[model samples]
Target: MPTSDVVVVMVPFVAQGHLNQLLHLSRLISTYNIPIHFISTTTHCRQARDRLHGWHAHDNFIKFHPLHDPDFTSPNPEPNTTTQFPTHLQPSFNSSLHLRHPVADIIRSLAKTSRRVVVVHDSIMSYVVQDVKFIQNAETYIFRALSVFYILCFNLIRLGKELPFTLEMKLRLPDATATVSQEFTEFLKLQYSHQTFHVGNIYDSSRVIEGKFLEYVEKDEIMGKRHWAVGPFNPVEISPDVSSSAQQDRHACLKWLDKQPEKSVIYVSFGTTTTFLECQIRELALGLEKSEQRFLWVLRDADKGDVFKKDTVRRLELPEGFECRIEGRGLVVREWAPQPEILGHFSVGGFMSHCGWNSCMEAMTGGVAIIAWPGHSDQPHNACLLVDVLGVGLLMREWACRDELVTSVMVETMVRKLMGAGEGVEIRKRATELGGELRRSLGEGGGGRKELDSLISYITR
Candidate 1:
């Protein structure tokens, strides 16, 4: 059990990837008998609960605080737009600033009852908790939802240090500046400036795969801050029985995987924020059909500018007769699919991903190789880590040429190469080996476990 005088509050960015990371961390922290308050918009708070996996025994230790954003409006996406990034989410990001006052009020109220209120907030959400420094009984820490490799590279670039690898300077940097609207850019600026005060840093990363990068982040004079890499934050175990019936229903793909051969299926998902053009979607569908490989694809609409409103008219339609032709060879899940469960299954051999840090961590934990097709932001950097640094995946497309449409032929070729016998065999072996190391790191007395313990102790003290 932890000290009664201490309580921890979590503030995560509203995106699915960001929200999920902090929620997982909250669950881990709750295991130490520490109470956690997870705060976010009402929609996101509901998302966190609905998507939560594994055991529910620790639910009492964690609480959800949902704040309403009245000015927010979900805008319909322009499916024909040339931009590759999820620019449609700008409204949602801008509206999050409205939460500052309410979030601060909640923190102030909590501080009155607790001797120490430790605020762990997303790096992009620092502005929401800007008032923490003035609260006599409270302190704040920054939680980086990205991988250590990407974080190290970003800091190096910010400090004007030469990059470790040869790549376009623009591709390595955070692409939000180039892709987002001016209003969103200003919002980012506010967040950057407000992060001036924080007690320490926390990362959703681990020493096993990113040891050198983690060291660089900790040693660099300008970037160095007391930090912990207690990650692969998602549960490492595969516990099907722990899921509720509704969750089980959502994960019907697992039943299909059970019937497939060992390491024979590839799981494909671009995450919640990636928007695809109809033509591109068609090409991808045709490509999967041509690859002739067993696959499980999660086909969901991109997030709207205002997430609360549904854009029923502008749906992403698959190529006509595509599903019919690939009937037994593929499974298309139109709703939310249990990602961790799918990745951990025995039949899942690889993942075709956007290389978002959360997806990267889950893939690593599952020991699955990647077929990297990064869109924007830190995704390209993450793809580089998986393909070049880790040697456990293959890059299907580079970010420099992301503007061009990837044809059905190219997708087919790359998919076949990753699922077939030569280079794919080597990558899969390395992925499996690395996955073992990552899982072990979360075990008793391991590096991740120790770092988490140290973090818990620091907060309580």
Candidate 2:
């Protein structure tokens, strides 16, 4: 007997989005009856386990292994000192730099006991693709975890000449041609001529397998054909609880929304991690008030951290029933909301968002236009895609403000545009078309679905 069988190992970077992708992938892998060992820092591993609480038998086949800090074990690094766990240990920590060594070591150990071990990884940890011996599985599949459109944008930049400024500078510039290399300008030319946008190419295999948006555009060959993009996957079913937190919030919003007329509410949420200064929060509240539009706001208690204690969820000082003032008009509140279900709600007309990819996807898929309020990281890039490339969203100014945040005027303008009040109808039409295309990508026999099935076959075989 070979005494070796396939073991799938995943070490997702510690972040909500990254973890969500890995967990979704893990669920897909589990359906194949393959053994899986998902490795993570002690805290993260605990959290992942908690998400699936009571759902599975705690066993070897589907195991959650915690990597604890060596210092915390027994012999302290020194009598009074302790070794620091790698920064990747917590979801709130920056994970890019610290995960490589620990992950390489874990995969190496797994290889010793399994004859056919495979490493499934996220794009954020793309460095693993270069370490062959560390992951000596019969197969190693690099899971690309970005949308094909985003990947295309990245690849086009890579394929062309270096631009004078950074990619960010180029995207942020109001005029597209001002900051980029001429070669890129020409490439984008060919792209738009063909009804495509030249999204540069930097891919994650996990994304192609997990990204639910690849089925929209026509697929073409690029990078001379890489082993990547076997995915851009979409599982036919998402467990009701898979996104329960977001859903729970969504239900609450619906209660307020049910009282309003169709397409009357503008939804605002900055996502789980992003926080704004008190000044900015107040501006948003006032902006909602000024817009005179009915709204459902999900405000986090920690928006005023340091000023408030951790247990102080109740001391949320608002603009004095600004809730009462906006009464019958707007609802200002806190707690997690079911974002996707809310975006898809009939009452939601526009979204004031932080432009996270998942949020962008859900909003667009639901035919809701966005007021892009990008905070950091890939959000700015995604905002560019939404505003410049897709034309379905409006861009909020970069500066933070409470009075000026989403001022009543801006809110009303966005509402008119998003709700198709006048010339805005065109934007709505474009958004609706994109939603249809996004749906087609996930529909039965669609590219995303087919790709997902192909990924499952690859993992099981």
Candidate 3:
């Protein structure tokens, strides 16, 4: 059979996290030899181009097209590259606001020669609602990069008086324990019954849940049959050189971690896009300091200059000498770090995270527990899944003051509890078991592998 001529256009907002997901999907599509067109702002395209400079050697199988979106440019002077991206700008969202025009143009261009055009798009750009009819003769499929569970929640919110009158709309309600309304929950069940495909979590299938949650998901056709979960799809190699200049000093964080005892180091990162007000950053620093445990932190543009001028920004402040006191005991990365490899490292015992899906999945694969501080959006939801449902993480409430930052005393206490203190050993054991299952699911003929095959078949045929 002739190869299906399809144009898979990914109009990703610029942030590294969004790019990672878009690129992973692109790579999978490319492997099937489907024509893929990836869209980004000029700045983002340049970033991707720089990373690919040495990697692909001019391979044209995947093409990058930059849209002329003004939002792509950062107005502030570039802050010195640091541990995480400055919060002032989120490039990943640049194209989303004005996505329809360019996307429709691309589809129209492709229609001149291609028989069918299937556009797999990120859910955030659901604004495609307006342009969906404009893209001539193309079948559009929405791609939700989040776990199936989260997608189900989103769909529930989108529902109208559907049956079982979901838990969100129910008369009788569960206590403070259940965040989602019973009416909404029932609506989700009804949606599942109606045969809509919800993505199944590949990592969860291999994990060992505390109260047979895995068994429940396995038997429920709504979750088991429809949704596809392929996660932590970081395209960067596990080991990228730590230095840009040959002579610049490179921190030997992994080497130091090698000497530490197993499960001793806590990895702390707020992801590439979250920017805390200066006070919060300082409190976090002080909390880590008080914790006294060996730690690895990524501190990007901490002074808040990345978001706006420090003087102009009212809430910004980093604790004085916070790094000096914790210097040797911690390895602080200023820019980007190879996260997946670091998470998989033996020295990483636990994670202090912002609860992003990619980080959550990586932690799950590493079998490391988490101390979650959800900054925004779906992070809070992800945190709930980790702490309440999975039993693999501790929920850290939002703290504005130093006293509440889970000081060294609290850190030590929590670590002790998670390590084997209060039913800690069992949680650790379950996490390890889940990690093993995730590895297998990504391996030959595993659930993840099979799902990718099915997704490809759906798109290609």
Candidate 4:
């Protein structure tokens, strides 16, 4: 196995967070002169190709292997764009999950070439890896883009380490708030079913699983296989080189930040997968509006209501004219926000985040205080680590569980406390220290660097 020419094929879950992390990992590996081919369905492939258009790699060095499931017809297809999260509720999104044969065909073609074919997939898509291996001489690996705690806790349950606690009881953790319902559902789903994406659990473990724990599984083959914890992939490193659309958005955001006081603004955003019921959104909207603090809110579905209308994909109705109401004090980012850039800014004092591991890495690395609002899945646990274990930030309880409804008053109080001086000083300081530590870990001779090197070595071994 030679390092120079071996072809590593990376496939990601349909969601952009997973797709973006694997893409960044490919960029890191592109320097080895390895031909990296990314595979996904048509929509995901298009976005991947677009992002790599001006990539630093050599010409023809990187490519995409996109497949269409011939048997699965998309129902709400063309109207839904890549920017929005595709809920399985949409009849059009069925193709996102049914990729076994389409991806298998990609491996078959790559296997014909003299170079070895290794398929690295997101855990949500791990089911397809088995099918890829059945193709001639192909290999399979798993790359998880989730936080280590999320991985460790979930797997400990599967391994029965949390025995006798009973599934109904909260899975006790070193972090203060032990995960109960959300985590249990994750263990049950991943242990039993592969289709983790569910409408009710919106952003639940059903959509993603803890692949990091797979390394600990007692299988000889799994032990021998290549696995990498190659993430909280830094967006700051990749922000300087962004797609044209991304650059435009980045420019607008940075320009706004330039005028603000240092560390005075709290940046708010939920990753693509978290969808809010109207009441929840109203609470968040009013909360931010009434908080009377300088902020930026990237609302994924600002204009949405109880129904999905074909015409409303681009325009969402917030607490009508909410942007105007907050005018100078806040900015509501409706389109895709450049999160890494915002977090890395000096003026960004705090982050009101979804507690997605990726956002945690960015905010912590930037040394920004957190207003942890974990709506679903591992977020509540991620929030616990930030607030209780790490002592980095405070939790926004209004939006904790998926069904939890936060009020404007609650949101306002958190905003003032997080953005104002005094008690928040210690939390901010802790977040800064943690951010520095994480950045160092990903930097020269850092743990992330060593793991990445080992991954490269495994592929070329």
Candidates' TM-scores?
Answer: 0.93, 0.68, 0.72, 0.77
Please tell me which model should have the higher TM-score, number 1 or number 2: 1
Residue-level lDDT of model 4, residues 1-461, one tens digit each, is 32334788887866566667677667767766778888887666665544332234344667877677334333222223321233332332233457777777777777787367767677666665556645655676656556645655666655456522334324433222233344334433542353232101001111112233334432322223334555445543433545777657555777798789998898988776566666667888888877778898887642121112446364445888887788877887776666777888878999988787777876776789898877555677677667766788898873323344577887889988888888788889887776766656567787666766666777776
For model 1, how does the per-residue alpha-carbon lDDT over 180-250 read when each residue is reduced to its tens digit? 45656677778889878798899999889888877777777444478888998899996667457755664
Question: lDDT of model 1 at residue 446?
Answer: 86
Index of the highest-TM-score prediction? 1
- Measured on C-alpha atoms, candidate 1 has an lDDT of 0.83
Residue pairs clashing, model 1 = 73-306, 74-306, 75-306
Q: lDDT for every model?
A: 0.83, 0.55, 0.57, 0.62
lDDT of candidate 3 at residue 257, scale 0 to 100? 72
Order by TM-score, highest first: 1, 4, 3, 2
lDDT of 2: 0.55
Per-model root-mean-square deviation over C-alphas: 2.7, 9.9, 7.7, 7.2
Tens digit per residue, CA lDDT, model 2, 141-207: 4444545544445554555733333575464633323223344344335333322221222232233
TM-score of 2: 0.68
Report the C-alpha displacement of residue 238, candidate 3, in angstroms. Answer: 3.5
Which runs of model 2 end up more than 4 angstroms from their true locations?
A: 1-5, 29-36, 46-63, 69-115, 126-132, 138-251, 301-317, 398-408, 459-461
Which sequence of candidate numbers ranks them by lDDT, best first? 1, 4, 3, 2
Find the candidate with the highest lDDT and give its number: 1
Cα shift from native, residue 134, model 3 (Å):
4.3
